[model samples]
Target: MALYKQLALGAGLAALLSTAAHADLSGKVIGFSQIGSESGWRAAETSVTKAEAEKRGVDLKFADAQQKQENQIKAIRGFIAQGVDAILVAPVVSTGWDEVLTEAKEASIPVVLLDRGIDASQDLYLTSVASDQVKEGRVAGEWLVKTVGDKPCNVVELQGTVGSSPAINRKQGFEEGIAGHANITLTRSQTGDFTRAKGKEVMEGFLKAEGGGKSICAVYAHNDDMAVGAIQAIKDAGLKPGSDILVVSIDAVPDIFAAMAAGEANATVELTPNMAGPAFDALDAFLNGGTVPEKFIITESKLYTPADNPQGEYEARKGLGY
Candidate 1:
């Protein structure tokens, strides 16, 4: 009876604290600038963000940048003009953000970065919530190196948008991962703009240039959407994707897991869509309690393959607004 009484009291106190925290953010107006629905993971992030805000009773003003930096800048300025309490941005690109972020700071609106980080100074925003993107690429590359062993493998890379942080960092990290392995060579590389259509187009050209996909041993895409497109390109070229050319990418979206279940793809690194949860928590603390959070909050990056039960993953993530 004594233990039960203590447990009940602890539960009651925890509930009170949770309710107080929720009340601090209730009815607060927040502006979110998303980088458009470019991929499945992106759509999931937006959905989760909205659900989180609704749960917290926050009035969320959502903006889609449509993959343009100028549009994002315009939206931020609009949010500032509206005098929103806080602003969240998933920058379309890392550069070209100093001016608009400066404007937000001047207006006394706390800014939080979600998913991607900017190249500007650390003081420009309250904090950044993102995954270790370089490590994501390194994981994919390390998997390939282990899979192929000392075999001479010619790799073709499907890069993301030219100037995005994921594109730049993932490329550099993959290069570093495969540095000492002379047997693995990245022969051709090109930007797919992080789009499925462009990924297929670029891959088609790569197949033709590399002797109809005969010389290619692997294909590394910056994202799973591009990998899925590349898989189709390989199939159309009369080559098996996972068998002939090992397919590896990032952002373990549902469709990518489906591809892995069907033996179309090989591996992927997870970039979770719950970045908004941490971002909101940080905002709540900073806005209500004057508590300053860490400058960078990095989420986990786990590698997934067919052995990890791809079908189960596919089912679990199918309804996540992806």
Candidate 2:
């Protein structure tokens, strides 16, 4: 009888160990759908996210959406089909996300938005970790207003992707900043797809339409990539950039700091690219059944000018590792 009791106890212990091993979440898989490498910041985001997941022992399944909304949707669905524990998305556009997010919710998997946001119901996703894009634009606009004073500045704007949240909110906030200043007018505005090539093409058109840069006082771009492109356009047309045409933009990329140090660009709003750390922190909590606030995270940003663009700081802030 004592021998039988010992055998039963050993069996129970073995079953408990098996259960614990099955429930161990250290090797859980996470799905990450990234918008394609559009700029320096985007590339940094991708690198950091992968590194963080690997460090945390997460099997990260990644997909590149190539800057297309449809591609992101397909990737999200694929993650769901594969039964990943959680999913992360940096949406290419704000709208058209509710349907796929609903699918994720139905699958009992949590979703986290990275740099960009979606215009879905709050309950559909876990949380968003991103900078306040509208505020970034407002900061840039305020700097322009103070610097240009009451000087009737005719502005040429370089917008981002057509339907992205950053482009829309940045334009809205900039318009608000210049609202009471009747002398500040946006003479020409066009989408540059947030790329250097497109920004240059659109700026060339603006220069021609304004009769070789005499009519424009400043250029406000949604991101530094576009601003850099516009600066090249100004130089190619035989005009000095900062002196001939003032430039203000968002995303304080390393290249933009170099431009500021060279006096080619005026100001930029800093959009830090280290979003993955905070995202994984939040995900860990949610997956562990901890209660997460609906709007759990937000990244802070600041404005950078030539005076503040120190050499060491510029090098350290180049790519998003923080």
Candidate 3:
């Protein structure tokens, strides 16, 4: 996340608030509720956010929700009790956020969402910092369509946890990308829970069910870690991954770039872990000058192909907590 991700309070009550002219955030304490280290990108996000907070002289109080809405709710309440300047959350799910957000609002605390969004009203939070998940899926889908040409292809999908915003929106984008291409059919679809181990296990099942990868042309995963696992599964099934079955997914983690350099994976859409940058900027502007920032701040969803210098990308992100 950077200054480029956010807009100035586009709509809603956030737009009506005036920005303060003076900015001084030193010695201010802030509470952050992370969605846990569920993926490589999430772990990196935690690392980056902490580093950014230190640079800004902001005391960052962190809480890991372990992917549970109840845990997140409890953490928010605790932050409210502490009366921190603001609260940041990377939601585990979309629903069940109204009550907690309302509580934050009542406390006069600005709540900022990171990475994923919740079903609660936009008025409840200051803003959300995230990437365009739907666009990520569309990019992967478009790449596969171009690589396969007019050849009739059957695709097997490894989706993230069921009902998650990324999973649902990514699937929608994929469908939109290949809408007119009847030759490309998503054959067997299943959830891999967005983990390397589960991705491998589910991919094995997909190989067995698809007649040993004979009918499947490509594999699309919701995250790069899953795609990496699926690649290993393809190899263990006595098949070449890059030539036998194409690989493409989202979340441009360091491992995914390594896979691309080795030609095991085809492409990945980046979900940058630097979301804290924009969040802190908006918070600073709001507190210093009463500036009402944009309700939604979107980060980049960059597509990295093998030709985009995979080895270079890998070296660049490896030390960044990926």
Candidate 4:
């Protein structure tokens, strides 16, 4: 009888908590600091964030930092000054946020990290929502491992912006995934700045250096956009992307799906842009007396291959502005 009473009380309290959370966030103001729309993924993220705020009836104040750390810091201070209810920052660079985050902590305005994390004390922010970058790389690596099997594979990697967390973690993850694969090796690697033009230029140099692209077996780009650019480079050198040289990358953007459908690319790991949906959920829960969630809330890192209906995937993402 005592156990039953405890269970009934617990249920009641849970329902009460749910009600409070739902009530606390209606029409609340949220400030979001985004790393500028440097890529299709970032643009989609910004769009999705706005849609989420509208759906929840929350007033959202957005700032784009133009891919600079100082601009991001300035935006954060501006949000704090405006007395916003909560702050969401997808930090441009990881290290320089301790002081600004400290100010937010002192003001008692809970700050949540969206899509990217800052290098700071955990207590400074409410929680972080992001994709496991290393895992994304590992997924790409694993696919190539399975595809190549026992064949000797020489992979040339096109890394993202140097020193960015995604570039760092993703490279580490791919290395970890291919650790024991003796038949596969990374021969040459360079930074593409996560841009198509740079990816193409770097790949052109790699082709010239590697016996007119014959010495290379595969291309491992940090993102699908780069892989698409690399495909053009391979074709210019009289090599077929899927047959003569395999192409694998992270971020399943719509262009990548088009590449896959046309047989110019092999596989990609997805990095969804719906980061704000989870961020808002965590913010609401915390504002209504719920404990801060697990520090790291990882987003999905789904893999898409040509065999999984590339045309359908392309069509789905086309309207999403990717």
Candidate 5:
């Protein structure tokens, strides 16, 4: 699987580099309406997006929506008024985007979605750049199922923001992954809002409700930040995180690796923060050569465990603004 990921990533990068060389975004103004820095991975994504824009000489106008759909809609309107060449949005939720997206389309402004997908029509945006969120969740679930074997296990899920695509899709995929595993039951699930503080608080409630963490066998967090927070909650309750309650999550952020190195987290699915690379590539093609890119440009999602050199992984990603 590692070799396959390397080959796939290499091919994708080669294609992107070729497209980038042929198309120039220099001096082009692009607006990025970001979902706020709610997690470490989100922060890394924002940092990488900025770096990619700088590298391509694109003038990037950024706005932080602070996890609010209204703020994002306002930012998009602001970008349209400025008549920017293109717009990028990491929507906070899937619904309520049709109206704003339609406005962008009517203005002849191509909008590309990042990370999370929206429930709006395909024609509303140029393309969506994101990982297969369902697959990430399934991978985490499969890991738990395999590790727990035939033993009966109770799992609790720490979900992302309510109504968000990641939270919904991930929850569905995890259920699918553990469908036939009769021994593993999802006992409780609740929203963590994809934040460390909220994750910790919700986990504390779960621990209290689940016999002080004794009944829970594992925790499935929608993101690494939540997993890290849950680990702290477990410690506060005088329980070993990885040993007492197996921790599995998506988004292979640096802190998650640090936890894995310390034996606090068991596994994570890698959700690369470089969604902007393909989004930028698509914009360059459309703007320069009038080429129409694929409607959905998917990125790779790989699973990581402690055996994958967690300490090295932690060091490698620690400097990427996460």
Candidate 6:
């Protein structure tokens, strides 16, 4: 009887130790609302974020908004209802986020904006992890201006989604870049919805309005997918891309590197896709009773031209998903 009692006591103590070790996490849950897998980069971001959460032993609740603002709002409210410890939102648009964010703040839940920017007051959210979109546009524009110096150039612009931050900032930055360049003018500007199909449609319209490539000197796409789509349109019109219509854009996806290798694309600005590393780091710090600043974490971007795209380095990075 004495030996049996000692054995039972040892078992109870082992169970108690195990429970205490597991309780170190404080049983925190993280909720993430993604803006749908519209692009390769977006899909990569979602995948990496999920993997990061799992690796960190965070109970992550994920919601896909299917690229709709209403869906995102609904998902955020759901997270609030579930009383998640933290929430991450990749908003579809810049506006219409203040109310949902306010609710999270009221609940004392920290919200992080990922890959996109919001127009609301900064106090509504904790931090934003995104690329300097305007700077990306400026880099592309500078390359174009240098390539076509002193020549009267008519350019067609393939903008991103109508109200997204990348669309707004890229447009503004490109306009700023070409401000004093008298010889370069934007002949056509339209939204491509950040997809290849819409990019092709918009490019076809630009070709018809500008009389094909005869009058159009270049194409400036907000993303590589659009640029790739426009390349097909240029080809179908019997014009040689990179030679007849110089192509420049952002997002160094694998396809764009292929285009550059084939001489269909002239230049691109790279936007890295692996945003999960920094995001998880920030969240871990915040969860450990550490205060994080209102950070506007900007990822580094590089301009890639044919002269520098050797052995398909852009293609290799594209597999990395952002």
lDDT of each: 0.83, 0.77, 0.81, 0.80, 0.84, 0.76
What is the RMSD of candidate 4? Answer: 10.1
On TM-score, the candidate that comes out on top is: 4
- What TM-score, over all chains together, does every model reach? 0.75, 0.72, 0.78, 0.81, 0.75, 0.72
Better structure of 4 and 5 per lDDT: 5
Off by over 4 Å in 4: 1-25, 66-83, 95-100, 161-165, 208-211, 319-322
User: Candidate 2 vs candidate 3: which has greater lDDT?
Assistant: 3
Candidate 3 residue-wise lDDT, 1-322, digit = tens: 1111111111111111122222267688899998777555567778877877877788999999887779999999999999999999888777988988999999999999987667788899999987777887887888888889999999999988887667787889888878899999999899987888989999999999989988888999988878999999999999887778999898787899899999899888777777777788889989888999998887666678899889988997797776
- Clash pairs, candidate 5, are none
lDDT of 4: 0.80
Question: In model 6, where do residues sit more than 4 Å from their true spots?
Answer: 1-29, 54-59, 66-85, 92-108, 118-121, 150-152, 160-168, 190-195, 201-212, 284-291, 307-322
Comparing 3 and 5 by lDDT, which wins?
5
Query: Each model's number of backbone clashes?
Result: 0, 0, 10, 0, 0, 2
Candidate 2's C-alpha runs over 4 A off are: 1-29, 38-40, 54-59, 65-85, 92-108, 119-121, 161-165, 205-215, 284-289, 310-314, 317-322
- Which residue runs of candidate 3 sit more than 4 Å off their true CA positions? 1-27, 65-83, 92-107, 162-165, 205-215, 319-322
Q: Find the number of clashing residue pairs for candidate 3.
A: 10
Candidate 2 lDDT over 73-140, as tens digits, reads 99999999999999988887779988999999999998988866677899999998876767777778
Per-residue lDDT for 151 in model 5?
100
- Please give the lDDT score for candidate 2: 0.77
Question: Model 6, 1-322: lDDT tens per residue?
Answer: 0110000000111122233222223356888898887656676667766756665677889999887899999999999999998898888777999899999999999888887778999989888877777888888888888999999999999998777667887888788888899999998899997778888899999998886568999999988788999999999999999999999988777788888899899998876554544565566667775868547766566777888743456555555554
Residue-by-residue lDDT tens digits, candidate 5, 1-322? 0111111010122234445543388899999998887655577778878878988899999999987889999999999999999999988777999888888899999999987667878989999887777777887888888999999999999998887667887898799889899999999999998878989999999999998999999999988888989999999999999999999998788999999999999998887877888899899889988999999888876788999889988997897777
Best by lDDT: 5
Ten contiguous residues minimizing lDDT sum, candidate 2 = 1-10
Instruction: Give the C-alpha lDDT of model 1.
Output: 0.83
